[model samples]
Target chain A: MIKAENLYFRYTEGEAETPFALNGVNLEIKEGEFVVIIGHNGSGKSTLSKLMNGIHTPTEGRIVIDGIDTSNEDQIWEIRKRAGMVFQNPDNQLVATIVEEDVAFGPENLGLPSEEIRHRVDEALDTVHMSAYKRKAPHHLSGGQKQRVAIAGILAMKPKCIIFDEPTAMLDPSGRKEVVQTIEHLNKNEKITVIHITHYMDEAIHADRVLVMDRGKIVMEGTPKQVFSKVDELRALGLDVPQVTLVSHKLKTMGYAVSDENLTVDELVAELCRLS
Target chain B: MSIIIKALTHIYDKGTPNETVALDHIDLEIASGEFVGLIGHTGSGKSTLIQQMNGLLKPTAGDIIVNNLEITKGLELPKKQRKKYAAERKKQLIEVRKKVGLVFQYPEYQLFEETVEKDIAFGPQNLGLVESHVKQRVMDAMALVGMDYETYKDKSPFELSGGQKRRVAIAGVLAMKPDVLILDEPTAGLDPQGRDEILGQLKTLHDQEQLTVIIVSHSMEDMAKIANRLIVMNQGKVVLDGTPKDVFKEIETLEAIGLAVPQISYLIRALNEKGFALPDDIITVQGAIDAIQNVLEKRAK
Candidate 1:
């Protein structure tokens, strides 16, 4: 579980008129819930991710991770353990040459026993479907494989929640699917809370809740159906919804009696059929 | 000028145990004015092929002849004349490469000059253009990429945002006025709006300047929108090359190779499978809307 109260962050530019990266934000995530945060480039999404993991403390607020305050310098390690993060670039997160070693790196640092580290590494690799690649070099793996390994590294830490900051941005379509599906599986089957930040609207289709951030604030928050139904609003914010949702909205605007709650292709098609 | 490839083969770390046949005798062509999209799984030889196209990477066993100049081959300079020959080849290669500018992925990181105007003027200045000509090119390139010349000229390259930095980096290449502009994932790290802005600029450049734009990207939506032609690579082979519709039609083939068709195509297929009888050939959201309308009209009939 994660909660933020009046979170505000600002980069110290020489000029006092520098804009805030995040300003007066409040958000809460329930345990085992899957949440996706979407926004434009300068919308403080990445800054929020860093703040959640205590990499960067909030400039003027508090973020509590599972009762551990992010501002508490002594509990920084504990907060990171509870809320692990996977970054945008696959090459950057992976710190080891071998797949299993990278996954075990976190557990090793936690000073877990050797046996426990090995066991956790294997389980994590199995969860990401990278067990066969346990001995391969990270450089030899594809972008998707490297990202899965990164997720496994986070999983080995046994975090209560994992925050992925644009994990699929650098991958090919196949790579993106592999990483997204892995995260979804961890959320659904493993019951690990997931906070995914992405620019890909289609990836948000199955999220339990979606948060739209703009200019360092939470502009919109709802279920995928609730959020994507307002396609024009998303467009006005320079954001987008899934293609099916966009088409459904277009039809409704064109005087067609299509349902607005259609987020997926199947749902949209069924809406069309019922209207006909 | 047209770009031609004949049995182009690039082998990485050749003669060693790690010899990789990156490109396996690939053949291709790009007319003077055409927009092409390259799609593939990781390590599918897409980058290898593109580098060879711009004469950046030489082929191991084949040749790429650009504008009637057989690049890096067929010129057997003797050891004594090698110095003179090398200088001549370097000058000619510069001329050839200037006509075919290649922008690597995340091109913004390539910017190094202190001012935006100087960075954009780097390529033309290197080509030994006069100061006045270079200044004209710097302003023209800035305008072409949708940047204000007077506003961004004195600004440092590092001061810009991710999207703006990328545009500035692109203008540096655009200043060269290449016949063919090949960009590798020009919108890799950009947000939706930034991606649209960059793609829009590329579309305008291709249309007005008659620039041959080849975009190497993984986004099916982007390729579907802009590229008149699409090239799909797999396992060091030109697996598919055709129009966007033609290339995206083989959904199973693409999926098998870890590539994907546009999301609209999936919607149409799902509808047909569910007995809605929607047309299966829909590729874009606009096309899907028209198809759904037709289905509704048919039901009324």
Candidate 2:
């Protein structure tokens, strides 16, 4: 469980006054729920993710991870261990030359026994479907594989919630699909609460709830169907809905009784055939 | 100028245990004044192939001829005449670099100048152009990328926004007056608005300058809208070379290589499979809308 109340953050780099990077944000996440946050670049999605895992302290308001308040200095480590972070660049998070060793780094730093660290490392690799590449050097792995290794490293810490900030931004389409699938599996099977931040609208279509942030505020929040149906609102926010949603919207404008909430090609096809 | 590749192959760390084939017997011919898009799965030799197109990476075995000049072949000449051949090859490469401007992905990270004008002028000044000519080229390059000379010329490149910094980086390449422009993932990490603006600018620049434009990107939608021709690479080979319409039709092949056709292509194909008689090669949004509208109108009649 994660909770934020009236959270505000400002990066004071310019003059005496710089606009808040995150202005008055409020959020709550239940255990094992998959929540996706979508926004344009510089909309504070990343800042929010950092705030969740104690990487960035809020300038105002409060954040509580599980049972510990983030503002409490002593509880920062506990909060971070409870909620791990997977950043955009996989290379930055991985510190080991080998894949299995990288996964072991987190638990080892937590002062776990060497045997326990080895066991956790194996389980984490298996969880991310990266067990086969345990001994391989990271430099030889693909981008998607490298990202999975990063996630496995976080998993070895045994965190309840994982915050991924644009983890698929640098990946190709297949790589994006691989990482998204891994995230979904972690949420569904492992019961890890997922706070995924991404710019890809299609990735958000399957989320339990989608939150849209703009100019440091939550502009919209709902189920994928409920959120994507508001085409004009999302477009006004400089956000893109799925292609199927766009096509269905066009068909609706042509007086066809088609739903504009379609998020996949198969959904649109089935809807069109149903109308016919 | 045209670029012709004859049996080009590149091996990294050759003769060592870590030896790996980066490019394998590849042949590609890019003509002057054509807008082309290169799409490939990661490690499919897109970067290696582009590096070879310029003189950055010499082919391990093969030749690259630039406008009737043998750029890569002469490098493999006999050692007896090594001194004379090496001089000629170096000269040719220097000349080739000026004609082929390659912009790597996230080029803004390479920007280091205190002022934007100084960064853009770096490429032209390297060519030994006179002061007046170099200044004119800097202004021309800035205009090509839609950066105002007066406002940005003196501004620190580090202080600019993400899109502006990227534009200035591209302008640095353009200042060299390259006839052929190759950009690797120019729109990576940009916001949607910024991505569209940069792509629109590239299209306009390609039109006004009549330069050979080759863009390597992973976004099928953006490439579909801008590129007239598309090259699909997989496993160090060009799997398909054709127009966007033709390339997108090989959906199964693209997917097999871990790439996808543009999103609208799937939508149009779905409609066609659902018996709407929609065209199959639809890659752009406007084209798909027009096709769907025509189908709906026909059904009404």
Candidate 3:
């Protein structure tokens, strides 16, 4: 539901010699597609996410969200409503002390009726499996729980897609799993579009497609299996493949008859099982 | 340089409704020249335990001895006796802090000086070192963290990249020349390359200087690569303590507590379960590759 045409963004205002944060990025995401973007720091993936939600307008080109042009000044609010964003820090996104109130904050700003806002808040909390914590304070929750609450807040706004920018970077391992699973569930069952940016390679294994960015450009794009099979290229770009993928690639290089496209442990195990 | 803890318990907001035990009755001993990895979930008392090492937070009831200096139960004396021993207590805490340097999470935010050199020189300057000695320590610390002294000394820390800013903040701690270095989530938000660079420098420093290094990290791969021992904490308790292999072998228990083993360990276990005969103890990708090659060679024979 997001489209970008020749997206170019730069931080310097008048310095033409300064490097662009995003240089010549052209992308399209169909409705309900789960896309993951991976890159090293300063790779401009975060810049791309902010552009999708209209947080940063392109300096040279344009981005259109669902038919709403992000560069248009008046439609910025409508664009944000159509595509919500959940940032890395949940504490920054949380607006209210109470959990349910924070979820209701979005609809309340949308000027919905009180009954409607309440209904949407409850439904959103239930969708994230956080109904039991509806009345608890946001600070008392774990990192994963806080992120889920932040997602619920976005859901209450009824966005067609959600952009997660390193949502698990600050969390522990289990917190990362919880947030990743929640994102997957949103895409699979809820039919919401997802654009996840992260440094964790394992989280990208199940994505519908993966985009590899480097030095402000979309260097690679393909299905998870198609992209992750090139282990050395990804490493050269300062990105990592899944551990299983790396192991399988190493075996294939050694002429072990193992499939190089294995992205998960079970798949690699099955591949080696047939070999012996 | 050695740290010994006995019956440590830390409670936040004590005697109130919000009273929560951040650290339970925990006991740990970290010898000098050892590399230790602390792993835990959010609110697992890992940070609390590290802060205790540097005397940043006092325990409610416990005894902590750092290089034979008892830090607990001294600052909490009654009002009259507390005043009587304030000077002695200050001296001991300063000595403890000098011996143990802590690089907090998001340490780059703690950088306040005007230039990179000034920021790195802050600790040594505070330690009352002479001007020439402070400059020497700053240069040495910068080199240790893989930053060039001449190139970055005059530059503002804010103008540098995220990884560079992080190195400068770490150099600020290293300038103190502590016997023990503790960092919390040093690689939290850095990219794979940045993470590798920072961990590589820590490993080198540990080897060359024989500095006691304790790092709290969530990346099991990093811990597996660098740490000689791993300590897993959960709900204010030390649930497991052993080598990376021993701790990661309890994968089920770790998962149940919101922690995870390295991804290679999962692969090895799954392969073994599927009758591939791969060794279940392998936790690194290279180790798994070697094990798989050995198994395949035997099968071909």
Candidate 4:
């Protein structure tokens, strides 16, 4: 649902010496695909997400969301509506006091009818399993709950795609699990394209595709197993593989018959079990 | 410095409709030179307990003694006598504050001085140290956090990278030379490399300087690797306190309370449940590897 060609971005104005935040990134994300982007800080993953959401247009080349070009001024709103963005901080994204009202804010901006907004809000909350918290204040909820409410807000807008920029960085383990599961459900069940950018390697395990970014370039791209099996390369890029992936890789290096593609604990354990 | 707590209870918005107990009648003792990892879900009283240790929050009831000084003793005095002893209490708290350093989350935002040296020197300068002593403290602090004194000292704190800026902010705290250091989520928001660098430096400081260190984190993997002792809090109370192996053994309890052991623990448990004779106390990847190797070799025999 999103396409980019030779994407280049630089924050500096008229400065040739300053490096580009994003440089020569070419990408194509299919509709309903769950794609995860992993990188170290300053790796331009966030920059690519912004370009996809039309928050910041490319300085060189272009990005197209669905059928609309992000750089096209007239279709900027159209691009945004098609690709909703959820940020890292849940408190900053939430606007209204009450949960349901917060979910309705986006649809209200879209100028939907009151009844339609109510219907969409309820449906969105149900999708995220947050209908029970509709009447509660947003501040009273946990980090995971607040993030799900934020996701519900985006869903109420009925976007075809959503770009989450480190959505679980501020959350605890359970909170991280909740947000990751919600994102997975949105992609598998709801048929929405997901572009999740995060530093957490474990969250990328269930993704359909994983893109590794480094110094403003797409350095690697493949399935989670295909990408994570190169444990040393990922570590050289300042990224980490899953703990199980690392353990399996180490065992392979020691002349064991473990699969290099093991991404989960169960997979690794089952492989090690066979060695006995 | 050692921290001793007895019946510590902290209630936010007390006596009001929105009153909530942030910390229950909790009791904890952290001895000097011990590296403690505090883990809990958000709003689980980990922060409340640490703040009380540093004298940032006065307990609604109970007493906190730091380095043999009863910092929370004055709070229990009657209102009239409390007023009379307010000056004495303030002086005692000031002493405790100098001995215990508490670093908040995202501490880089706390750096506001013009240069890195000035920022690190801020705390010592505030303590009325002379210029020479402040300079020595700044140099010592920079060395402790593994920052070069001559290279980045004159540069503005804003010009550094996220990791460097964080180290500089931590250097600011280290300049005070506290006997105990408490950091809440020290590695949050940092990349994999940056996170490892900070944690490695903290381990070095704990071993080399013998500084009593307490770190609050949500990552069970990190705690399992670095902490000598793990303290788990839940619902404003200490639910489990032991070594990482001991605490992670109660995986059911941790999962029920919205916490988790390291992934390696789960792997070992799964392997054992599948009829393998692996040890369940493993929490780190290396520990798992060694244990699994032993089991596999024995099976091969």
The number of clashing residue pairs in each candidate reads 0, 0, 0, 0
Residues A135-194 of candidate 2: C-alpha lDDT, one tens digit per residue: 999988999999999999999999999999999988999999999999999999999999
Candidate 1 local lDDT, residue B194? 95
| Candidate 3 docking DockQ | 0.84
Residue-wise C-alpha lDDT for candidate 1, range A57-78, written one tens digit per residue: 8888899999988999999999
Model 2: DockQ against the native?
0.61
Cα lDDT tens digits for candidate 2, B1-301: 8989988888999999999898888888988888999999889999999998888987888989887778875666676765677777888888888889999988999999889999999888888899999999999999989988999999999878788999999999999988899999998878777788789888987898888999999999888889999999988888999999999999999999999987788888778877898777788777887877787677768
Interface RMSD for each predicted structure = 1.1, 1.6, 0.9, 1.1
Q: Cα RMSDs of all predictions?
A: 2.0, 1.7, 1.4, 1.3
Per residue, candidate 4 scores C-alpha lDDT tens digits across B1-301 of: 7899999999999999999998899989999999999999999999889999978888899988899888876678788877876887788899999989889998999999999999999999999999999999999999988898999999999988888999998999899998899999999999999999999999999999999999999999999999999999998999999999999999999999998888898898899988887777889889888887778778889
Off by over 4 Å in 3: A15-17, B73-85
Best candidate according to DockQ? 3
Candidate 1, superposed: residue stretches over 4 Å from native: A13-17, B75-89, B274-280
**Could you tell me how far off, in angstroms, the CA of residue A58 lies in candidate 3 after the best superposition?**
1.1
Give the whole-model CA lDDT for all candidates, comma-separated. Answer: 0.89, 0.89, 0.92, 0.92
Model 4's CAPRI class is: medium
Q: Which residue ranges in model 2 land beyond 4 Å of their true spot?
A: A13-17, B130-132
